[model samples]
Target: MKANRFVTVLIVLVFLVGGLFAQGQVERKAVEVKVLAGVTGGKDDTENALFEKEMEKATGLNITWEKPPSGYDQVLMQKLGAGEVYDLLYLNQFQMYALANQGALTDLTSRIAASSVYSENVDPDELAKIQMNGKYYAGFNKLEVFPLVNVNKAITDKVGINLNTLNTLEDYYQMLKKVKNYMENTVGRKPYYPFFTYMPDIWDLQPWFSSAGVRRGVFKDASGKKYAPFVQAQAKPVWEWLAKLYREGLMDPASFTGKTGDMRNKMWQSQEIVMDVDWAAWTGLYNNNAMTAGTYPHTVNVVGLPGTKSPSGTFMLEQGGASLWAIPANAKHPDEAFKIIEYMATKEGGLLLSAGIEGYDYVIQDGKLAFTEVGLAHAKDHGAPFPISTQFDLGVLGTMNPGVLESVAIGKRADVEVAPMGYADGELDARKYYDIMSKWMTDCIMGKMSADAAMRGAENELRINSLID
Candidate 1:
């Protein structure tokens, strides 16, 4: 009787285990999610096929990537305007802001608040940048400062200029003047390369004026009025300062243009430019090139060219994210959409998206993120494992090309200015704003119109549009 009872008990236990295993195998419906992927050079369907397949397997979600041929902002705006809102929308702050006010995207305040992934993984400072009116509408991108002053020490020695004496606009002018004279006298009229390059865009010009405490896009004045630098009273002196450099033949008028490779060739390739205010990634790359080719004798020295003497510690990347992903108010499968986001915040999703399939695409080398033979080959064919959907892996960045970290110039307040909370009132037109400002800037710098004239005209336009007062 004891033997019979024990056998029966064992059989019951096996049945219970079988039932639990079968329950776990219940298949979930594969949710089809349409996403506007603006971050990746997701240039073509073929380019992202492998990535899409990998993501689908990893997340148990189907995704369709809609990539615009060109002009990401314009394309995203167009889709929203035409009432073709996709399930997932990825956009920069301005683009997101434009739609966010219209009640288009979902308010993710509560969602992020409840999410353990957001609270635990995401940095507090990063979370702060993505908030509007104390609510998070989008996920924050990792912030990185690229305000660098890469000076060729060899050239500076030849010109008899010391970077240690650099302070205020007057000091900067002297440095440029010394270099300008050296180039003309020693090298002849090849071209005067003043370390000039704008990252992200020409509009994000913080490296040049941050020291004097000027923020790009929108900064606050002494009166606490939020305004763009071009229209601000404080910016006048800075403009005058730059104008002085231009007029003195230290700054080349021809260098300021839409053309590419003009500044790079002079600064990096030709080795003619003396001082460059740019990002570390490019500077580090240049350093590598110089080292390899024996072109530049000395390493490109880092310059602290922030306008103010107080030194604003390390400058923050104000607009760090390209576009914060948002779900449209008129979306189906909202649950699935949130699921995707939640999964993305997980370590599994982050690795899959950033480094690709570990054994297949990448592998750990010395406990650091390293690409395998497979990853290198794929990178050569397609773009490397840059997960545009998220911040890739912060860990990978620590092990990344080392140029990115070396490019960071601490103690410079790049574009330190004040900006009032929220968007400019009324319908915001980014195209008109950028167009007018770009032309005005080039005009002012190139001498087509005076800075005062350009500012006055721009102020009137911004005021009319209710962008500023």
Candidate 2:
């Protein structure tokens, strides 16, 4: 009887130990995740590689990155429609809205609220961007600053234009005329045209429209009960300005139909365009590298265009929010993925990804962040690699660069002042309005329609869309 009892106890002990071992094995396995990310040239070659390496090192999670062919929205819609499981998904404003409206994305309001990282990192105003009916759906990566007008110093000097005093609309036109004449008479070539305006994209129109105090298509009246359409009123003056420029040959003809990539190539490679509006980050990267390589004629300087109001006023509609890192609703290992996102937002993780390992990638000197030679080369070549979207949870306020902030100087001018309109939600579908206005605006600019007729047509279309209702 004693021997049998002892054998029974031994058997039970073995079973318990085996069960524990099995559980441990399961826990040790890395969480498998598939992520869809939009591919930019720099991202494919550099940032993605570094992100993969760092994420693996920080968390044992293995991630598979996928790029959708063609439109990201179409790919997402198809995948969700087919019930395909994605561990994580990167979404732009349009994609976020479409998915949210379809009930495809999980509501992350509670999760974000519960997270110490999120609560600490996000600001009240920045948090507003992700909210729909007070529920948070998505996060932003980095706040997109207002577009900067980049000028070639050589071209400006050649035309005898004073950079500082060119602060009015009339002054700008005069400068462009001077450059056009100088190129025609002296160089026997266009030294540089006045502006390379990309008309096909709505973002290209933002600066001009905003400068005229036109806040999108909708603005609330004083009573708050009525919302007035700004486009009809504002487009008149703005389109007139554009028409004047077009007639004088100050604006590039290619701008009306060329793709953004084509426009960029013309500006950078041909060096025939003097002024173009682009994101400060992109301009910085291009100018920095081009100058370093000795391929560019002069260092590109960022200057603010003349605004109707204060320099910052022209930028009131500018979107400022955090980009988010989120696990998909169907994620197999949600907890593990969240932990990885958490780590990435930490100071150590940010430094590792942004600056890289200190001794090897960068070093602090005289209390300033200084990049090593390798780091400098990497920055010049790779640009910002880590998904800054994850860093949104860090709650750290970032200062704009001097050049970028300088572009806002016009916003501060005494003659210029920003009149606040309501929030310009990036994700909302203003497609119908955009389509109608774009068609009419193009027609008006091309002299196919009168400004008054275009304005009337736009009002009728807005009413039909129930925007006024």
Candidate 3:
């Protein structure tokens, strides 16, 4: 009888333990989501792997990433055209707008609005943005714009140049010329540094144009008539300014196309570049690197761009959010997709996305956050601390740009706001128009053709494209 009782007790314990195990397993839903343009990490990397392991446990998500190096553009486009199945689609601005217009994207309006988890995780004002044609079709990350002129004070002080007083295109050009002449006369003919924009992409030139009261290739006059940014009278000063930089050898040739960030960074790190157009955060990062290298790097002063009227107002990229994640109209697991997106959009999720696991990737010491040495080094190569929402930055980076907020040196120049781009003057295609103006701008800056010739060519293209009508 005693032996029978012992056996009965053992059997009961086995059932209890198994029941608990089953319950725990039930708590975590096994979600396998194929996500495009998700975070790409090295498969063999210990840190990324660890983070992913923890993230899976926390979010109950196993994400399969799409291809990289070129991203999911081509494959996605092909699949989208073929009407293939996908749960969520990550799109660029053009893609989001175009696809949504074609009814390929599902309207996320009701689901996102009703989601308490989503609402609490992001900013209060963010919901207003993500809307196109008054309907929310996607989710986006928030971004802030603080355009600054990162300059080396050592060079400027030596040249007896004061950047504070400098405004307008002519002022900047002359100052760069002075810096160039002084550098060559004192250091050597090596052209160690001159005036250089950081990335030099067409989009990067937005700062100068914004400062000049022309936002996104259009300027509205007192009558509110919109005119193209490349018009001769309006573009002359902008072109003339850059032309001098290129023609006089003051601006790096790479500035026209903006393909020389590596060379620019090397020069900046060595305290050789005089002026650099960079954001406060990255500027501070480079400055810190220079300091650590014992380069005696000059103090990088932040200034407003030339001809900026409202220097206080910087161009905010995607005032709505960073990248927009949209669900396809024909997605199978729409609810599951939203679950992942909502989780990723939360503060907890954002923290995980940006800083990674605390002990491995970063550490909090005395109420301050710092990246581990490995994390810091890896971050430089991997990319910025990417939170799904731009509002949550890598804590370490937030510390770097304290001075940026304090410096309100941008003059109250005219504020140029770019409304959403549409078919300009009923022109079905504005791409050729952009191409023409871009070619002109390039030609003018490279001195391959004068601004007049460039403008004439642009106008001819505009006419041929039927944009003038």
Q: What TM-scores do the predictions have?
A: 0.74, 0.71, 0.71
TM-score-based ranking? 1, 3, 2
**What tens digits encode model 3's per-residue C-alpha lDDT throughout 319-417?**
211356788888776787777667667666666655566777678887766778765655522212444453454444445432343322232123433
Q: Report the lDDT of model 2 for residue 274.
A: 70
lDDT of 2: 0.57
- In order, the Cα lDDT scores of the candidates are 0.58, 0.57, 0.58
* Per-prediction backbone clash count: 12, 14, 7
Distance (Å) between predicted and true CA of 101, model 3? 2.9
Give the number of colliding residue pairs in candidate 1: 12
Q: What is the lDDT of candidate 1?
A: 0.58
Local accuracy of candidate 2 as per-residue lDDT tens digits, 102-160: 67666777766787875655444556655665676664333334454566556778677
- Per-residue error for 171 in candidate 2, Å, reads 3.5
